[model samples]
Target: MTEFRAFHNTDPPQLLKLWHAAGLGRGAAECLSIDAFEVLIFSQPYFDPNGLIVAVEDGEAVGFVLAGFGPNEEESALDYSIGIICAVIVHPNFRRRGIGRELVLRAEEYLKSKGAMNITAGPSGLLSPYLVGLYGGTRPSGFLLSDPLAAPFFESIGYDATRSIRIYQRDLLGPKPPIKFHLVNLRRKMQLMISDDYQAPNWWWLTRLGRLETLHFELVPKTGEGAVASATVIGLDLYIPKWEERVIGLTDVFVKENERSKGYGQSLLLEIARRLQDELITKLEWHVEESNTVASHVALAVGYYQIDTGIVYQLVSR
Candidate 1:
């Protein structure tokens, strides 16, 4: 018989095992450890013990659900009144026993108790409190889309894919096609500058966890035209299960609204790539969201082809 109970801090080892079995906690040789979990997730301001509902069978943990809400001030931005189901994983050995569904049901109830009128399965849209840490990004593929079990499982519970994102992977293991950019001209005209160890505009949750070393580039105006564009390469890939040498995830390039269309964003991207290539980073990945047409175009131009697409599922409370 399977027993359901609230998760405790001591359950990290079991949960980490479950994450590995479920094909999660990637980018590492080992799954999240107790200390890692505390730094990556439990340290969040919105983390609630009740949010982690686990299932135990014969004293061995089998499955669990993690849910949470955004900060009060950011409710409007994230549909805070509507809770988020960050993750739901069941061990493969214990599959097809309704364990997954039960975990979600309990997660919804926990969110309802928090005054949520509706619930979203994951990052359906915008920045969310879901899938942080090793899976961190303002917008990433939904946890469900990455897992074969997640799609059908969520549908069975009335959750549907409200949004889908295209995940592009580039093979840096081979020689990269050379690309041209007017970087020198831009630097003189727009005062574009590149600096080491760049950080992005702070987001509360991001500041607390999951930040890796990255490069920062920005446009400083010479004519006092104000900021033109700013981008940062955030986070490293293949850090877990051992580290991938000379590689990093290419993310978060922002060109000011008025400054867009001059190829600033793309210029920044290629420049970052060139800098990395010089340092022997042969593998680079550029992730593009469905709505980010500019970045999407850049990904393709830079020889990145479609490898995987991720969908964000949502369930409105009934």
Candidate 2:
């Protein structure tokens, strides 16, 4: 008999091994580390270990599922939930036993009990009605499963592709900023631009949730004396629990249309790297719209490599 129970402190090492065997990914591997797991359990407000369910058979853990919810800024309600099925790995020996389905069902029930209005799962490409039944409908930015099996499974269950965001990373050690470009710290120059009248406050709040610091603004010069130019805000988030190699996440890099192709965006990124390198950060990471070709090109020009894709899905409960 298979029994599903809450994940406990004693389970990290074993869970890590299971995740490794499932060929999850770098992010999952990083999160599964014993130290990382402890930090997530204790420090993150949205995480609940009791919401993490593990399946055991004959005294060995064979499968697991995780769920949680957080404040929905869009709705201004604390009851909004964003359920993530961190992983649902079944021991190879336990395949074809219906264990995965049962695990998902239990996870969904747990989320509902916790007052989650909607649930999101990383679906295998293979079609499965059971997976689709979890949500009233697939969210606008639903999670994407690269695995051949997982993709169809989600589609068969009713999840559809809404949009995809591409993750990019750039190494800072190789190149230096161009000498001809003048780099100005926008944070000091554009204090007037960040007005309460605009959505700057909302952006600032969201950046805080992502643990970002060092918000910088940039301006591009235009031809006429009275002509208004393009502006952008670049923010950085430092990853915590400082390891041997520290990294910085560049979140919300935006530029106005008038400034395209003038090298301001690239210069701003270079300035950010130069500033943070003194602090010992070796890598910079950010996400961009997959469809934004110009932005993608600029990122590539600045030595950023497209690494992974993440999709966002939204669900509204009736």
Candidate 3:
């Protein structure tokens, strides 16, 4: 008989074991470490232990799920409570037995209990912030498209593939692509500034109203020579830490509509890449909406290559 229960203090070791046994080690390397579990999942103040659960068969944990909400204050603004299925791992030995489905259903039930109007089988704990670490970022959002089982599995379990994302990556140790430019003196025309505050452009998931320091960039538009700044944020690039490799994961990049198509986005990325490269933090990565061809054009020009794809799945109560 298989039995399910809430999270316990002693569940870390078994959870980590099951994570690896489920072959999640590739995308979710952080979960392979007990310490990471403490930082990534348990460290979040928003984490709900009651929302964490496990399934056991013959006295062994075969499956587990972690669920929780975004900051409570943002609920009203969203018009619906958004909850995340931080993760769901089922041991390979137990596949085809429907354990994965049971674990997800249970997590959804708990999320609904906490006033969650909709649920995402995406990154949890750290709230809506994606790519904060190796957890949510390993793919794009919901699950890796390469996983084969991911798309169909979530669909069979009542989750809708709400959106698609394209992931990009490049190795700094490899050939560095030349910073090509079509706009004349683009570097002199715009000044790049870096700061951390809520006003910074970042991943949409970062709407939590707290003092979380977000590393962001802003490109000030300059019109004339004497430093008479237009004070317009023409474009920018932003990132968060991925401590394991000391890599700065690109979270967002944007250029004002009128400022776009002039090869400005690529130039902005070049600036961001140079700053990071100068600090020996050469590696950078990020994702864009699958339909965003304009963004993809600049990313490719700046040496970023297509790496993986992930989907965002959602289920609404009504």
Instruction: Provide the overall lDDT of each model, using Cα atoms, as 2-decimal numbers.
Output: 0.66, 0.51, 0.63
Candidate 1 lDDT for residue 185: 68
- Tens-place lDDT per residue, model 2, 215-299, is 4433333332321222222322212222234555554466556655755666667656666677676777665668888878877
lDDT of 3 by residue, 138-196 (tens): 22355777555667888887788877777777667679887444533778778777765
Give all TM-scores, in the order shown: 0.84, 0.62, 0.76
Candidate with the larger lDDT of 1 and 3: 1
Candidate 3 lDDT (Cα, whole model)?
0.63
The reply for model 1, stretches above 4 Å from the true place, is: 25-31, 71-79, 124-126, 136-139, 144-146, 173-205, 208-211, 220-226, 237-246
Question: Model 2's lDDT to the true fold?
Answer: 0.51
Q: Compared with the true structure, what per-residue lDDT tens digits does model 1 show for residues 222-241?
A: 78875677765654542433
Winner by lDDT? 1
